[model samples]
Target: MNQVNVFLRQRKDHRRWVALFLALACVVAYATLDRLKYNGQALNHKQMALVCTAHGLVAHEHNDDCYDEDGELRCPLPELELHEHDDSCYEEMAALVCNELESDGHIHDASCYERVRDEEPSCGIENDTHEHSDACYGWHEELICDIPEGEGAHHHGLGCYEIQMALACGLPEITEEHVHTDDCFVEIDMTPDEVEELVEERGPRRTPSWPPCAARTRWSIPPS
Candidate 1:
């Protein structure tokens, strides 16, 4: 009887040990599954971040792609097409007007007019004490010895006379029959040939075109 009781106690202890081991295994499996789930979520978020960065969609505010989707953000590649040249792309150019030098109906010279001199007469006597004689008589009142105080007079022999000098001539005056020279021509801007050459070299002026892929959009998988 005691042997049977001991056998029964041993069987109960073994069953308890088996239950504890099974419980420990279940706990470990649950914890491992939870860690794997968390890691998977983190990896998915990192991959989405990389995709957004590659497509230049990191800034959500400035991009229209961020709001095009129904409930999530989507990034798409740009579509492009080659555009040919057209006349509408260029602005209208006006015809060029060139100016040239021409004669202004005038002439220049170094000698066109002559100079003139004036003269006056005085008594031919030598001493200031000589009295009025026939040489000083019958002359103009201005040529007489009675000179004004500030009349710029000097005594020559027995007379007082005013001497005047002439000034040197300056630039010549214009005449009625003047001839045109290179100096008489008016200055001008660019010539017509020069303007034509510039136009040929520059070809045509063009207005700026719209950017590539500016009018289109595409769709892709929404980021998690």
Candidate 2:
């Protein structure tokens, strides 16, 4: 190679090595700083992420928040004991921690468990209060038993109400044991007949916690 070309090539190689070394150095520095931040008792977001990563959890930008493979929020530690409605993280709990931290507007329910924000908030703590059925849907209800087979498809053996509500599904293969709750309902300016027609046309849809009303407010929100 010509001298100039050889010189340029060497310079390019040198620059590449410098960049690689700098990147490695930055990583090391970051790791050292993160470790140093954890003085003794607890961890911040970055340190929590490292610990969570070690335990097969995805660390998020939010402080001490992590997710499991299924995208559900997870506890950071594997050994922190919690009681009363139980901690959502179970390990490094969020409810009581948020209280000590005094994060604006955060509150624990009578059970001492933090209330779940919205059904789809980025990081709502799981209360682990509700039991799951084989398959659950609308009305926030659960079916402990599966829908009965061909012989008694219309009848859900027990813990289900068939008289007040009919199986919403039309397919013969469907066996339903859904129980509708009356705890809460949204009101709209429509007659019963109109609502029924609208429901028939729109089909079945579980209500989402629209507008994240459950989110703890650091500041008051004006209603739309």
For candidate 2, which ten residues in a row score worst on lDDT? Answer: 93-102
Query: Taking the tens digit of each residue's C-alpha lDDT, what string does model 2 give over 38-72?
Result: 54323222221122222221121322233433454
Candidate 1 lDDT by residue in tens digits, 1-224:
99999999999999999999999999999999999987775554321111232222111222343322243333322222233333333332222122222233323232332332223224566577976555554442232223333343322221222222222122112112222234333333434455357547866543223323311122122222
TM-score of 2: 0.19
lDDT of 1 at 165: 25
Clashing pairs in 2: none
* TM-score of every candidate: 0.26, 0.19
Q: Judged by TM-score, which candidate is best?
A: 1
**Where's the lowest-lDDT run of ten residues in candidate 1?**
214-223
lDDT of each: 0.39, 0.36
User: Which predicted model would earn the best lDDT?
Assistant: 1
